[model samples]
Target: MWLTGLLAAAALVLTAPRWLPARVVALRAKVFAKVNGDNAITFPNAQVGPERFQEVYGHPAANGRSRGAALSDLFWYWLSPGAEVHQEHLEAGPRYDDVARTTRALLSGPADELADAAARCAGRVLDELVTGRVTPVRLRDLMVPVWAEYCYELVFGEPCPRAARDLIAGHADDVVTALKCTGLRHPARRERLTRYLARRVAAGDVRRPLPASLSPAERVHYLQGTFFNTAVVQLSEAMAHLLLALAQHPEVADRLRRDPADDRYFAHVLDETLRLYPLFGIAHRITTGEIDLGGGTTFPEGTVLCFSYPDYHAAGHRDPGVFDPDRWARVPARAAHHIPFGVAANRPCPAWRLSPLALRAATAEVLRRFTLHSTVTHTRSLPNRGPCLLVRADGPPPRHLAALGAFLRVRDRWEDVWRSVVQLVLGTVMVLHARRLRLAGRYFETHDTAGCPPGHRPPDHRERAE
Candidate 1:
């Protein structure tokens, strides 16, 4: 009879959500409607374009390169798993140091005993192209002309008397042709590259091919390369989101500017920002096992469902209406539940640690050098969040800038002191909680009682008749 009652109770618990108060459903529907409407208003004609894939130069170039390096480092760390590779090499090194060094000497060096001058020249040309600083006309310019010189240097262990330059002055087209035909597809990407490579290849250019000694498979492997382009794109989107948020909430930017180096504070601001304006508002998963998520929602095997991150964040958070980090500050460590990236059990961003760390580092550095003050007005009368800050980079001292300098410095210092105070307070509370827990454990062990131990009552106990 007891088991029957328990089973019935469980059934009610499962079905309770479907029978939830109408208010809850209406609230969720309203929020979803607003979100969709905002998306349409902001990006009605959103679609990927050809120029999106092409590289940018100058400041954009510098920014992209920085993001690319971070991405490369993160990828290598992910691939190696246990290898404690430094981020710098993961960003720039061709491969593991030993292998990269050997390849450089053979395919990229001036060493007469390595490979040949052509290979070396080709390496230089490709290096420039990959960096997006220069463009080349042909493949031999990179492979034949450069490889021959490198090979001669490797075989004889001495500088070739022949000038490696003229070996392919007019043969640049051949090298470009090989690069275009190599491998990898993305119609837009291919189209842009073909214009550069095909024009030269059509001019009857000739240069050394990757040494006939290399097996076809090996040659293909040599051509297959890794790039940080994906990382660059992701980082750019993240930056755009962050900038937009900051523009909307100038006060948060001001707070962060006060103590830019405090990783904890920076993290809190980012968390709140993400909660309010998540980059990925939803994530989906195919269930593999039976699990009960309270209210009649028993997810069975192979069931596909999408988890609304923004909605979950709103529901689990203390005060969903406000963009306040103080709410996060108040959540008990064990009960904390904000999933800007995704849920803790299954994060959408597998590279969470690295990506956030890179972002924090870059933001901290930028804040250190400049005080970003903006006067840009946000788009009002819409649910969409965006920032329009007129950014001004200010620093150091001048006679007229004295007052502004003092204000900025004071603002930064106050944030530092405030964070230290909060940490001290939290530390005290944690120590008190630990002491209480230990004492309670000892009392229970001695008294041999289960549940709430007899008469050393819980705090806020009610008086009873004697």
Candidate 2:
């Protein structure tokens, strides 16, 4: 009976989001709203439970006071994961007297350099894949290292040394790690990188001005952090997605190849690919005071807010699930809301400007060189799971074969839809079972002590008033 109830409850929670009435969802959304503010909403983390927060930040003290004074610090630390260490390093550094000038100095470079590097790297990787020169070659593996090398060259004015690659690759476990060092897990590697960067600074090869406030150690950390956080990490994933997108939509690929100089077409395709498979699926922000997000939904101060790219696109756009680059042309306003790099207001990626340029160059080169055949496989991970495509260079299929391939792609999309529905159903059933058991247990605890079996009740509770 207990097992049966548990199963039923599990199914309900899993399916609740899908089946819950629109009004209920809206009301729930309102509950997250700030008092007296319009349109701003908050995620109290109530529905999903507090486990995630506790897991990331550790549990609050027993008396409910945090170890830190500033809530924003905790919030930022939570959102960016490993950024606090880098932020600390940046803060400890000598403040650059002219931040704007320093920023300009950091960003200054001939755009063509990045483009040339991207084209070269893309050509080499695609050639290897086409010729079967490398076995078990994954697109991301090739792209990450190649892009890393290019970025190192662009930033440091020389090729990336083998040691730097080893250190960066070793530490780069995920997107956050790419941005900042989370801990002292790789102390030896960190030390080596510090020494290497310090030497580079001394040589005066790096054109980017170091803030006078930064100590030598902080300067090293800042350079390493900035280099890693820039184009390489995000662009690699975006480039992978673009390849898969082109392979699946050969019509678009053909169009791109035919008119390689059409910047609008390239931008549309990149934008659409990002929309379909964003590098980071969601962006998190904490409310500062009350915010009116319009529609009578206001979020209170300290509320943890999430902007899910997928959810926003799905709710706002027509046929949001489909990969149609043409839609961007029709709905220019929709494209404005696309935030693949990060939100502009809060934690924007420093590489946002260069990333698109590099992607455009790399993608154009790839399409020009080879006709791609690709299959996208999705992992079972929730939320963050984006499209991962397995691609092979098939040269170019014959016209008849290409038509047949397009048909199959459409059919495959339908199959994916059905698969998602079936999975949702199964997940919903499990959540329902879990919910049922929870309610049953609550009832049993509250009013049915007389019916409790021996050894089931707590020792103190087992002793009746008599």
Candidate 3:
């Protein structure tokens, strides 16, 4: 009887790789909500489906950023040192406008101009490697230096040295790793970046205007939060997703390579990649005043609204799971449910126009040099950092990538079992720690704060916006 009981326990443990991950994920989300307190409401508010995604997202009353200051704590903790000044977290008003203006100015180049710069920077970053050999590459890792140089030039009109590239890449990687719950926040690594940006800002190395409303310190943090940190992190992540998509779908890659000049095809590919794997996840806002959505539906003041980009993008489409760029031929990108960039009325991505153009250029450069291939299961939350193989484009048909892909797939599944567990532990701890730290709360208390009092919303965190 004892032997049989032990054997059963072992069997359960052995097969955990299959079932444990999903359970752990669901539990983690529950813990996350509990720790954070579910005073907020989620969007695509089931009653409406995807029909009112934009309506709620773009609503003027749903425009408050700092109102839900407790949720901001988790974000600020994860993206610390200068996270308080990250443009996305700032409340709407003159300060946001100034930061937005600076961003627009920096990203103001023509589409062709941005593309050329991106291609030039990308081509420069790709060092010569052994051809005809399968090389495992982390797409985010590869794209970081490319974007580091490109973004560096955007801030300062000179070439980025290898040293600067390393610093920028390290800072960006640390932030992304923490954001993905793969690692803990390392304030020392982030502080080093803060110091560097401080010096640059003091020296007026910032060629563009920062928020004039900020003090000297706030100016430094603004540069780090906006330019060096968020811009580099996002652009690199988007490039990784794009390259991974090309790797998984060789037909699309082959077509792109054959017609390297086809910007339209490239654009479609980018739109689809983002639609499938959006960079931003849930972007939540708190209402400053009551919002009436006609039909007698109203979201009361301080109602926390969560706009989930992944859910919104996945719904109301034909075979939303399938990766089909041809779908774009029938409908313009703007017309689709895709909001890769946020809603224009409520703080859209400042680089909306430039991001697609830069990604297209960087991808074109990559395809010109090498053929990408991957068999790893592509996921929206690519915490695996996009496993892929790079083959020289000019080389003969490469050998079996199946072995590598198979290994990655298995490794990823097991990793998910452990990673999910880690996320639960870390996410809960950080949520609690953030609540204690009250980074955003402190910032708001000192500066001008927004409307919502934490935990004052509906009956439960599970309550929805009707």
Candidate 4:
């Protein structure tokens, strides 16, 4: 049994390179054609490639479909109210009833409230980055923890459950494993979920006396796990989109810095980025009953259906294949045709509002501070592109730092020293984490062979591997 466990562990880790991202991307691509169906639109096979993703929103177009569609779906799912069908579950119970309400309260909350909270969260980090007090690598370290904390608060509500937050903060691998298993075959998801649950329970991070509304099993599914994979996936994808825009048009950042009130410009850049590279393509639903998606194609009851928001949004814009924020600016703000998150028929993201607020706050703060450099090596995901982790490029000229330095000069010297010390300590901790992953990789390679000397080599501490 133990040897079998080890083998299973190896296979689970191996799947991360393909399985995790594919789970999200595959769903997006499969639904590219069904986003909208007015029954009047038709194309005579102009769109080519996989027949599965051909007619986006029922309008047939040829030659372009990519991960950008998925990112748009993620954006919509995270921001706006879901489609009519999605609201049904929310109405079914009080537990979920608050999902949309709380989301709206947070995003469309009082402008003062949003500004104060956003500033508090971003203040120090932005200051550090702008002043060259920390490197981009160090900024990533600070940003991930801060962003994680913020997201947990949004998802679970405040006063944020300390144990749940700590479990996520300390055991990222467990969270990643559970997320990867979400839509897989039952036993596979159950196997990974069980291990994750046991670890949290052992750490005393999960409480006893499961909620009265849940059986012990149901409680474990909903409460014990965290959405750490989504956190990293979305954050990295958002960061990439933001950076890519900055790299392509230095003027956009300049305009943003000079007139911070022009929130529309920031939105345009974000929209363009998503259109070019979405995070999760489309969301899936097994049809509960027979329904006509117009155009004379009636999907029978129980048929799996999806709507491709990315395709619809891309199709409505000019040169859907290129990266251009200007095209985004040309569209109106509340246009349903943009469908970056999810549209009327197929919205799936529960974090719709929370994600955009977070992304906007983070993006606005960063752009107002530093000029990000361009990289020759780009990262391509199933849906988006990020800076190659291995590449280093010269960032935009350093003029912004001098301006920011003058602004921060009001603080006393001692306070500045303390902040720098704290940042340095955080940087060291990140270095140690990287070292741990390196060691684990080497150890796994060394022992993963036939006839190796074996006796309890402890399952490489599951949570950190993610």
Which candidate's lDDT is highest? 3
Candidates in order: C-alpha RMSD to true structure: 27.5, 16.7, 6.7, 17.6
TM-score of 3: 0.92
Error of 1 at 321 (Å): 3.2
lDDT of 2 by residue, 234-339 (tens): 6666766777667667799889988988989788888888777776543444343555435664445544444455544444567777888887788783344466
Each prediction's number of clashing residue pairs: 39, 36, 1, 25
lDDT per residue, candidate 1, 1-466, as tens digits?
9999999998865654334323333444443333222211111012211121111101121111112111222222221211122121221222233223323333333233122233343345334333321111211122233333333343234553344323222222222222122211233432333343333334423132322222333222222111111222234345445554564465777777787656776777777766665654433333334545345534354333334445545655656757676565677423554555543333224335444654564454434333333222211111111222122345333343345435544443343334334433443343334344443234335532211224433222122111
Model 1 spans > 4 angstroms off: 1-187, 190-230, 289-296, 332-334, 368-387, 395-466
Q: Please give the lDDT score at residue 352 for candidate 4.
A: 59
lDDT comparing candidate 3 with the true structure = 0.80
Cα lDDT of model 3 by residue, 198-239, tens digit: 888888887776766566887788777787788998999999
Distance from true location, Cα of 66 in model 2, Å: 14
Give the whole-model CA lDDT for all candidates, comma-separated: 0.35, 0.50, 0.80, 0.42
| Candidate 1 C-alpha error for residue 250, in Å | 2.9
TM-score of each: 0.36, 0.59, 0.92, 0.51
